[model samples]
Target: MSELNFIVTLFIAVLGPLLAIGYLKPILLVVLDSLCVEPLPGKIGAHFWVRSACVLAVAGALVLALSFGEFDGSLMQALRRALWLAAAGSFVSIAFITSRVWAPVQRRLNAQLNGGRG
Candidate 1:
């Protein structure tokens, strides 16, 4: 393939899907809000972490699948790749969740120590 073709293909296959997946949650939330659905609660609530992890994992698999072009590869290989992607995505999600959970608590503690300063 020519250099230009390869670059375009790479961007479309990898970057496009990733960008779409990254925006999926926010987009859905906006749509739901537009429909007058009940406002969602904070992420610290029950099952929020698990749900986020699943979404991220599935998004990761889908994003990875966009670049899958080998017709002769074994099913096991594909499954392994998908599983790895899911695991990595879940880890990253958990890290974000942990920081999110900690940040508010840290801020509250700091405020108390600082004599109720905002």
Candidate 2:
């Protein structure tokens, strides 16, 4: 039971983000790309942070609820396991998104500072 829970938790942590990106990446990209103040996108970083946190929080709550119950072979158990996997995956996905969004900007900024065209 413990092993199952651990595996489910790990799966959730890993897979949730992958799915999130697969589904929500376009929106994320648009938000990130529209960050320039000249065009007035209205502060994407704050909006993105809030949206990500809300989604993560809801997914986390579902995972916690699913993973805390007694062991059983019922349908609820199966759903709970699935939710656990999703939660874990969601976290991983966000981490990936964060890095993806920040890495390029950081590199470009560094290049500009170094007198490069970026």
Worst 10 residues of 1 by lDDT: 29-38
Candidate 1 off by > 4 Å: 1-57, 68-71, 116-118
Say which candidate scores most in lDDT.
Answer: 2
How do the residues 37-72 of candidate 1 rate in per-residue lDDT, one tens digit apiece? 234444333234445544654555445544552224
Residue 106 shift from truth in candidate 1, angstroms = 1.4
Residue 36 local lDDT, model 1: 31
Top candidate when judged by TM-score against the true structure: 1
Report the number of clashing residue pairs per model. 0, 13
* Overall lDDT per candidate, in order of appearance: 0.47, 0.57
Pairs that collide in candidate 1 are none
Q: What's the TM-score of each model vs. the native?
A: 0.43, 0.38
